[model samples]
Target: MTTTKRFFRNKRDGKWLGVCAGLADYTGIDVVWWRLGAVLTTIFALGPILPVAYIATGVIADRKPAELYRDNFNPEEERFAMQTRRAPLRSLKDVHGRFRALDRRLSEVERGVTTQNSGLAREIDSL
Candidate 1:
């Protein structure tokens, strides 16, 4: 994946802006690695880098719009861009809010299936 996202929250099934998974998705690195790295960086550096990087990424990274998936992207650049970029909302719990928003749409699909079956039964009864 040559095309990288400077900063985008990922649409991951795993959670949060899907930052970790997205990071994993982009770099082909496991999300575990990204999490570990982030924690280690914070622990060792102690104060400045993590906070500063987060602030910078908030400004620099790109948002994940539909446009990104228009073509087959490598996601490698996007991976580094995220790791280098900023906070990207690093937890699955936090990103769950975005995924939660899709609940209505998903329910619509689920409901449609039952409704369709009911309609078929009604049509049969009418016959």
Candidate 2:
């Protein structure tokens, strides 16, 4: 997974654009839980301050692109991660095994790309 530098309006506790969701994306926390915490924080002890902050955040902070919430998350920070770069594994148990697997896959892809380029070069030479 490529690590895209995401920009989301997280000026406050959030629901849509997954402000909370975007936060979860950046922090590796569960979105549902963060949302709950924000809700609880607002409801229990704070004045209108929390709610007002949420509104302000909505207006100010960047919002995640609606479609990007899916598996392929692309956001703007001018730091778009390469697709081939693997995102940190959610867990090491399954992750350790995949490194070798990924290396093999990348190697194969590299071979194919290199072959195509070389063939193009050869054709140019012939011309």
Q: Taking the tens digit of each residue's C-alpha lDDT, what string does model 2 give over 62-92?
A: 7665454445444432122222122444344
Model 1 agreement with the true structure over 1-127: per-residue lDDT tens digits: 2345444655532344456555664555667887778778888866678756755654465546665553654565555444443445463444576478788779998898757587788999999
By summed lDDT, which 10 consecutive residues of candidate 1 come out lowest?
A: 9-18
Per-candidate Cα lDDT values, in order, are: 0.59, 0.59
